[model samples]
Target: MSIPHEIENYIKLQPESKRNDMLELHERILQNLPSCKLWFLDGKNEQGKLVSNPNIGYGSYLMKYADGTTKEFYRIGISANTTGISVYIMGIDDKNHLPQMYGKRIGKATVTGYCIKFKALKDINRDVLEQAIKDGAKPRF
Candidate 1:
């Protein structure tokens, strides 16, 4: 699907009350990560176009690094009850690297395998998140 279509569809799914909040969050993300290529992912997996799981409900921006690699920058997503915003980094399977790089900034963030989930956007350090995104895009074996 086209970018605009994806954006519209994703927005349509949100309650009218949260539309403005979502847009503000979306714009903030774009402003923060200028080099990333954005894509709206079905975190909840209810779209039926891809996977269908309810544990995830969020939008993501897929950024491709200069090294020809890419990573996911999740803006905001809902999981049945809670809301989250996250950015994935290198060694998704390596816990040591994440904490070493992010430290306490990863508030309530739990990493399972390669997925990193933050409690909210405000809790994270944007600079660290940006570096993590760049690190995620770095060549990995």
Candidate 2:
């Protein structure tokens, strides 16, 4: 249940070719969010069925839902997909902000409303990615 254990397990479960990239991204995120909180989601549903890729999260924020409910969640997240990796930037009010700001500069990554996904770290710009993570961690609402 420890954050390091969970992160190690998740990375070990990834394909051989993806492990190093995952590790580098992990370190990069940690460097960008020094002293921030860490989170690991095993991608399991209540029944323990796999629903998503394991996620390593950083920072903290209160997520408010439409029904006026709120819960604490990470501000940024990193995960490995079947094809590659995904960096999630949560809590932004404008859905278009990420794509507009990072889309053109991030190289091969796909910049969506809240996610920047790419086949590998070398396929994208590390500086841009770090900036996105830093921006995502700030409260924008």
Candidate 3:
């Protein structure tokens, strides 16, 4: 797949030392996410070309329902700065019932429209996170 020119340029501009690390990180995210159609959006750049900030506006991974009869939902991206990775999941509504079902794994979650912002990945369980991504998505139709 061809990455957007901006993303390609951005990656090309990264320091050679950090390039491999970022590539692996990006690949890990893609691997962890369920197989689906991948799309890229131009992330905002307020603080220059550094990838450390939440510069990549919103990155979405689209997944289809099991029956393939429903709409495809988005797993929004959140940059985990301290951890040097991004976390993907469904938004606020998904996080609502998560605490009871996920307990301490959820830690704390903040809502923003249909999306939720959280701090650490360790705070949420992987199974819970994946389920949230699946449940958080809305029908495309």
Highest lDDT: give the candidate number: 2
**Which scores better on lDDT, 1 or 2?**
2
* TM match of model 1 to true structure: 0.49
- Clashing residue pairs found in predicted model 3: 43-57, 71-140, 91-115, 105-123
**On residues 1-141, what C-alpha lDDT tens digit does candidate 1 reach at each position?**
876476766655665544444455556555555555555555444455645322222334455688999886543332321454333443344667766766566556665434566655556565665555555544454
Whole-model lDDT values for every prediction: 0.51, 0.90, 0.46
- Cα-based lDDT at residue 17, candidate 2: 70
Residue-by-residue lDDT tens digits, candidate 3, 1-141: 454454455445556534444454355445554454454544445665554443232234344566875543345553434433344444344445544544445445543344445544444355655555555443332
Compared with the true structure, model 2 gives a TM-score of 0.95
Query: Can you tell me which runs of candidate 2 are displaced by over 4 Å?
Result: none
TM-score of 3: 0.41
Each model's backbone clash number:
8, 0, 4
How far off is residue 136 in model 1, in Å? Answer: 0.9
Weakest 10 consecutive residues, lDDT, candidate 2?
A: 132-141
User: What lDDT is obtained when candidate 3 is compared to the true structure?
Assistant: 0.46
Ordering by TM-score: 2, 1, 3
